[model samples]
Target: MLVLAFASSVENAVQRQLGIAVSVEMLISAKTKVTSCMEYVLVWDMPIVQFGGGIYRRRHTRIFGDQGHASPTICAYSLTRNKE
Candidate 1:
């Protein structure tokens, strides 16, 4: 998980440096899939933040295991609010 976080940070930095335009919703969706190995999922209104001159958001939820084990998961969303 730490490695994935690091990679994500790096990717975000690279995207920012390249001035790429991305949606926060899309980022969250991507991150969730990349970080977890779940079959069924659901997401609701998430918070947003500003990073690298863009807006980012995150949502927290509980992931349930088929074997009755559950874990907490955080999904982060990011996007450029301005076009340059």
Candidate 2:
């Protein structure tokens, strides 16, 4: 996938610059429907390092509402491991 390729490139860059081992992964995350009125929801599990310590983790989710709404497609990437 293109996202995975990008993550790999990023990993290469990080290793080249900082000399730290980092791992990146991508996956489709299922999300629970909050209300019955909602429809066509897409979610992605995107984790990014917030701070420079121990691979800070965060989740990124993108939601698409009902019809006639402009839905945005999002790709998520996460760092599974970090060797500092």
Candidate 3:
């Protein structure tokens, strides 16, 4: 839920700042993961954008509840939607 919330915030920000439009087919995204403290973090250095242009990009770690490990993957986000 935290990750979803963060993603929603990011989407809202983008739509507000850049509007619901892509620039020359640019897909903005963020790396999301839940920490041991249940804190959500967005790795800005993680440069990955899905082909369909989802704001919620792939995850770098496999997290369940508060436990997670370094298992980078190009997975899909269930809590994602293509803006515009």
Which model scores highest in TM-score? 2
Candidate 1 Cα outliers beyond 4 Å, as residue runs: 1-6, 10-39, 42-53, 61-84
lDDT of 1 by residue, 1-80 (tens): 11112113433423432222323332346445466433323322223335787654343312321211122232222112
Report clash pairs, candidate 2.
none
Error of 2 at 30 (Å): 34
RMSD per candidate (Å) reads 16.9, 17.7, 17.9
TM of each candidate vs. truth? 0.17, 0.21, 0.17
Please identify model 3 stretches exceeding 4 Å from their true place.
1-48, 53-56, 64-84
In candidate 2, which residue ranges exceed 4 Å CA deviation? 1-5, 9-38, 58-84
lDDT of each: 0.30, 0.31, 0.29
lDDT of 3 at 83: 27
Best by lDDT: 2
Error of 2 at 67 (Å): 31
